[model samples]
Target: MLRRSRCRWVFVCILLTVLLRLAPLKSDSDPTTQLIGDVDNTQSFGVNPISLILVQKLGYQSACNSCSHRDLGFTGRVAGKWYSVWADTLWAAPGVTDPELDTPGFHGMVRSSVSLLTDDPLRVVDLNLNDDWPVPHQQPFIPFNEDWGESSRTAFGGASLCEVDAGSATAAVFILVNAFEPDLVGAGVAKVQVINGTPTVTQRFGPKGYWWDATTTPHYGDKISYRDERSDYIYIWGGPPNRYTGWLEGGYIYLVRVKAADVFDLCKYEYWWGHQQGWKPEVLTTFTTETAALWGTGQGQIVWNDYYDCYILVHLGIAGVTLYMRTAKSLEGPWTPDLEIYSTTPIDGGLVYAGVAHPYLDPSGKSLVVSFTNNNRIEVVKVWFK
Candidate 1:
């Protein structure tokens, strides 16, 4: 039953990808699936009307000639300005799928798109546009944790895509990363390496490499509230995206568990409450710092304060909050706010969206405390560090 289920999901994905690349499906009766990103865009700016039809569609020419056609993004001009889709372009519902289907719609010149596929066990679409600017196509996207060997193909083989999750390595180790989707590489994937490992660099999960399969789903040791003084991994912790039901309807923080000694190629970021496919995973706590931070700082950031050596969550805006004090000795902490942190410029920052946190030892030695500023609002929470 397990094998049969896996095959069904896998085949469905293949069908979706095939139907997407093959333009103009035969009929609207079959109800083919579409794989478009949330945003659509044309390079030209200030145009009267943006055109999605002009975007180049690669008709799986490779599946017949060389290798199979995989990960694709669009780059074209409309008026004159320059804009681009992400490294992976979004798939639109086939014309037959829905001529009226306009979602994943165009967003003027900043046209972006997302490719939606269901995780066999229903995995989350871990996307990191936490920042406004999209990552460059030339930049290396290394995958920190994914199911490499579960598929019939050898490890790192039979890949449809790959990406590097470089969260912890960047803030933690300061390793300068540089990689690219190999040239002439079919079913393309890139080779990632740490410039320095005296201490492991930022650990991250990206959707650029390795196809997802069963068996490699469950992972142990993921941290829920990220706070580490000397840990070497940084993870994008959260359950699947657009969860329409259950506790995760509003989204929740996922525990990205990785050993200080684990390589970027082997780290794992799992749902904090564990996987509950087709059903919404429970959010251990209602404190969704970033997404729920509706104060309007965008996605937000999770940072480890090198100065304080504790976690600082700067989420909302430039002058929001800072980690000041924790009221209790436990995670059920009624943390006290340091109102002065509002408007304090972040010493160093990024989209601290639950990726990294600075951990501190509580006086009790029984609890762990970490602090961060959401935008400018300072927050300090006690968590279990050991």
Candidate 2:
């Protein structure tokens, strides 16, 4: 009896331990909880750290000016290029497709990329939404290489797109990325690969892993970070891995810095010298849920309006985001918040997403020429603000 009792106690203890280990890790943040989900989840406007204007001039030309109204949204730095994600009216979503914001799956969730402008027609890789990385209108040199897939549940195919700043030579492409991959089922371990000749480098995470279906939180905006100060690294947030990934509806922001030294300066005769250069990225902090907004039932478009003067987050998910502004002078707390003037509801369209032109100043600076996706057409938002 005594031996049996001891054995039973040990068994119970072990079972309890396993249960505790498997217990779900809840996210403390609201937005983080919703945005950075298992499968998950832009640009621009205004200023740089140096305090110069972000958008200096604005221009528009419909790449599909002649096509049968195809959907395209892919922006690259090679000078005026974009590719939409949609194939046609059949590809429109409940939000953009059903514009009245009358879609049944009313949750404000954008699981893919939306291009603002395409230098040419829209191109799409024939891959699953949650399983492939698309190389916008352009074709990959290596036909065997798959674009890219959503690694962790937090990311929604790890959407990525490029944007040409309004006034600066500095261009960027926000991508759904993971610096590290966790060992779990369903969560895919990601590997970032740059095009063979795009003057860029790629990084690979740990062995491929899968996501845990149990985590269904919403994942939002990719985290763009600068590790070396030359260029920035972009990370797509999602759920998985007991450690690095946060289990909640949240936003993951990673910083990848690109420096002049890291680039291959053929003009100046600089090269990698046969060295492998990968994206060096790190996580900032995760935004909580209550603080962030959502797009469901009634509202949509929870976006961050970042500028050089400050990072203005518009919580359109709730009503409008609490504008938080930070400047190069200081990036700490107690920044200015635009308690007013940030519109909550869309006037003409439903949820609005900025396209390839991440809000730069126009030559006029009196207005903001922003390209956004509505239902069918890639429309531009002309902000007549100072």
Candidate 3:
């Protein structure tokens, strides 16, 4: 039954991608079709007009034909500039997928611009902006934690700035990284101290080199965070192996949170145990079959929108090819059903993932500048929710 169900989903996704590819690719207007049903009445997220504008690649075309790069995480402005951390980068000739070509990870900053939400094209310049910076390739943001028992492993496969301590003297930033070690593929947190505007690794917090919760079973945190004023806590999201696929990539996400001020301490971390059951002292991993998820999958981000007065979650859906959006009044419960927001086949001939929303780019929340990856190329879209 599981095999049959999976096959059916694969068929549906392929068919959807094929149909979407036929849509128009021109910018500054709606696509040939609005994949989310009619734009008139109920299906269009109510009567609001949604426009996807300036669908262009985020940076210059790679010098190599088939460079593969994906998974972008944004950092707080350090020394007057914003940074984007990427995972598994490669610069190679066309059709090159050799494992040896992997550069592991790297970071870059957006070129000097007054605003990221502008309609003009944007560029994600390499860290070469600073000549004295030790990292020429912007690699090795977090060294492999030997304490995690993965000493033989090299750099972290993925990294994201999950929390920023702006009030501190040196603006401490907490980064969540995926070890990606064969035997210990899980998540860990490291502290990055910004001194004189440059980010430097300080220390690592938590024992989650391979997070087991209390069960000690490995899980993957997409390393996405959102602060809730009602609880005054920043919720960190992780996903266990999918019930269907048995892969930790993205399915049935769970939450654990710590006070923004206490992110360095593991004792303060609390897990969600449903609305009625509330939160508990110990790390909560076990969940009843009846437990509900805020939304499905990872490889995305959650941003609070002031215009809609709700939190908008943009993620690469379970199908793996499509990008989806879901909205909720609060971070905890009662999220709307998956709404197909963008189709990659129409833009990049498919094979796209890591759909993230940049709320910092649009302070008004009326329009969102979203970034996603297609092989080595990173593309941004300006989505206006009218």
Candidate 4:
């Protein structure tokens, strides 16, 4: 069953990519920003209606020549320093998938880690499994565990992070856990601790007996609250239902909120069931419907922009391969139509996906810092809103 699902998903992705190439290009009237300069011989291509600028290019090359990392899981400020979590692997090249390397028990299995960002030359610090960092062969902050499943190993490539107070004496890091095997994908929430500037997973919240699978429940954390000012609760953007057919599909983004004091109480979370009629609290329901579609693959960033008095959402179109932005006055939003920010074209023989926004990195409230994953590198760009 797992093999079949994987095969079907690959076929669907290929067919969708081809269909997108054949579709007519979307027209945009919004004013955009152009690339300021080039990096690593790669220039930004396509129109960015959101005025995104290429500020700096962060390369992942480590002192150890073989391993590399991609997939920006999440970034947050911990103990007065900026840190990012990413999915890392030991593979030497792209497009080379060895089952031995892909399996859960593989020594070089994909794992998650937190890295400190430094300024002098724009490089990563304290990178796990890298010679440049002090920590070597340190256990993954969120490693594949026995409780997940016999064959299930987890890689949180698209995870989101937020700082929340669990009413504890120490600060806590809330992560949207994305777990998957070759056949299935699931999500949940995990509590992480910063021990001496390193992230250590301490607890998890989700369904009983099984990992947070989409086929079993409608509630799974996608993006956690980045800038909700409320001290009482933390908000999470939920993803689509995980289908057995291997394609997780949904057009509307959902909202889930849990009390900041009760971050670990999975049963206490409230879903936004409100509609056009009015707002109401429900146990587990979607925040939006099909009529108000927010297109994406459920991996993106959401930040509150005080300058605009609204929430900004950045995501990648699964079919179009374009990065887009939408704004809403409220968390349960009547979101504006997607304004094309940037689109991915074939670069260095690889495709791009998962364009996310880093509002904390943007010094000017009007400028936005965006990051996207290419086949070989993670590209970061800056955008200014008109």
Candidate 5:
């Protein structure tokens, strides 16, 4: 009887241990209860010190009489040997005064490159598609077919570019935020590839009545992407419909991912359905009963911080006056609550928005080159997180 009792106790303890290991981790603060079950399930707590300094407002001194632009949102990416940025809502006229804000001939987007030299990293120059670098000129490169229905009649508000592989490869996946187009009412994807000796762009519009199935509605505005070395997959994070889109729904965000090689294949997409369901082949549609959010909603970018040994998210407030930061152990995370990092008064007649962190600009990850739109121009700052 004594031996039997001991054996029974041992069996019960073993069962309990297995159950605890299988249960999902929960957080009181994170509404989604982010389930980090993979190998990189590490968490960091407490406050991390961060500092922000005004680097310089990026200026464009253009001689191209056909280079007028809009309230620009700067989303930078490392394409080939250069840092390329998607400059949204461009016009071919000499200049666009405030009266021309609603002008009709606004081409959707253009590509610009920032000089990657250590001397001046914020210099915006024209992109040389042949060599895949920035030249000493200010004329932006129009790499897409503006006459196409997908590229025409649309103005982008935000963009995130994920290079398929690190290095001189010119192939990448671009996610863009469509601003107030009656037909293209949300986000879209563009596959950028260098064919033969020139660059070529192929794009697909996002959830809309005419373009794609409107059931799977995911707002790519303020969206960001990161390549996980462990999983060898690039994760795209996006959320809460832009209130400007006339979307009065709840503010929630989700994540989707695809292998680097399969980025251009929409059929290979996988949606994050939390710990129980894990990743599903089907997307998170509008009517899905269960929804998950990636640390709430805001316009920002996520970068891995060597100092914090975690992922850091630097984003702007809804009003765009204050900038905030959040830290998480993993990409799919129980992220820390918003910690106000910087706040400043907006310039006269200018609102601050479209803030994102450029990691390639600061290779050491000690300081970040952050950019945002202020006074209808893109301004940059240096952010330090110790």
Candidate 6:
């Protein structure tokens, strides 16, 4: 009888061990609980629970001429307040003739500006543009001039902002400029300083061609950078080649990184060379690409989520008609297959692009505040990750 009892006790211990191994890991601050109260067991995507909720639509009441229509840009925290820059256009209004369109000396006159978002009354303060700042009525932010040649007469917009410590008295604000020109589209880098609670440009660096632009590198500047506190490095993620010209067709994602302090130096950047070898110092080196296409058009945002402990990328996919989400454990990732989070075809008949994620706006960390341009209007939505 004693031998039988001992054997039963050992079996019970084994059963408990197996049960603990099978149980899903849970944390007190798990975002899954905050975003989705209860998840459906029968739902697809295995254990990945994701959902999008349209929290609220934000609009700006601007007095600038032809500035009523705007599209989402990057947002960053500055001086204890959240600031966002957006692409402002006047062509969206009826009877507005944009002379810059198709004019040889003139490229499309789409410019950008900054705004202060206040939560108390939920209003956007259109900060008065500095004399040097680019406005549709004035000059381009990163001006495309006679030096750039006739093919490159365009302004910068759809920019992403990141604050870097240049070891100066004030933190430097870096703006990744996306330039839209005829025939050739590319990205440039610009630096701005916050003077008296306003953002102003201090330096500008390229509508510089992509690393692989010689052979028609389709999409260039969908590159998004975030300072990874854990690694003390600035992680930059770029998009795959475009189907345009069929040079390097397919939606592929690429990644690169630089020290947070060396963000201003392009030479210091390192590319994710491959899985086996890992990050390569050469920026031009070809690397292991994302297995699946993240977006049809390469314009979106990739943000690090502290709560989820994963990187979330939001982009306009499905031939530029839908907003999709993909998550990964690392920036140079074996990213999960693209999941359709929202469709924009119904929202203004598919005149949308640049779906960017703003984590600062959402405190819960479970819901992401995303903004996209629909018919020249910047539309905001909240995506809840279950």
TM-scores for all candidates: the values are 0.27, 0.38, 0.66, 0.68, 0.65, 0.66
Q: How many backbone clashes does candidate 1 have?
A: 66
- Specify the poorest-scoring 10-residue window by lDDT in model 1: 60-69
Task: Report clash pairs, candidate 6.
Answer: 240-252
Pairs with backbone N, CA or C atoms under 3 Å apart (clashes), candidate 5:
none
Q: Which of the two candidates, 3 or 4, achieves a greater TM-score against the reference?
A: 4
Q: After superposing candidate 2, which stretches have Cα over 4 Å from the reference?
A: 1-76, 79-335, 339-365, 371-379
Order of quality (lDDT): 6, 4, 5, 3, 2, 1
After best superposition, candidate 6 residue 333: deviation in angstroms?
1.4
Q: What would the per-residue lDDT of candidate 5 be over residues 1-386, giving only the tens digit for each residue?
A: 99999999999999988765545456534322232233221232456545444334344223121233434333434444434344553433333423234366643344432222222444543333232122122333333344444453344433455667545444444444343454335554555554442334444433331222222456543356665545667787666433313221233556777887787677887877764467888866531213454533456677777766778877774546777777777676667767766565676756766566666666677777666655545556666654
Residue lDDT tens for model 3, 1-386: 99999999999999989755544333423312211121111111332223444343344222121223433544344333455555544333233343236444433322111111222324444432223222223334455556666442343433235445555523223333433443324454556665544455567655644334322421434545554534556666655432223332224556667786776666777777656566777765443322324434556667778887777777776537667777776566556667666666533454566666666676788787777765545656666675
lDDT for each candidate structure: 0.25, 0.28, 0.49, 0.51, 0.51, 0.52
Best by TM-score: 4
TM-score of 3: 0.66
Better model by lDDT: candidate 3 vs candidate 6: 6
Q: How would you encode candidate 4's per-residue C-alpha lDDT over 88-181 as one tens digit per residue?
A: 5443333223212333333443556666655422245544444323224324656656664522355553355555642332233444344444
| Candidate 4, number of clashes | 4
Task: State in Å the error of residue 99, model 2.
Answer: 11
Model 1 misplaced stretches (Cα beyond 4 Å): 1-191, 194-227, 232-235, 245-248, 264-271, 274-298, 306-309, 317-386
Instruction: Please state every model's RMSD to the true fold in angstroms.
Output: 22.9, 14.7, 12.5, 13.4, 11.1, 13.2
- lDDT comparison, 1 vs 2, better candidate: 2
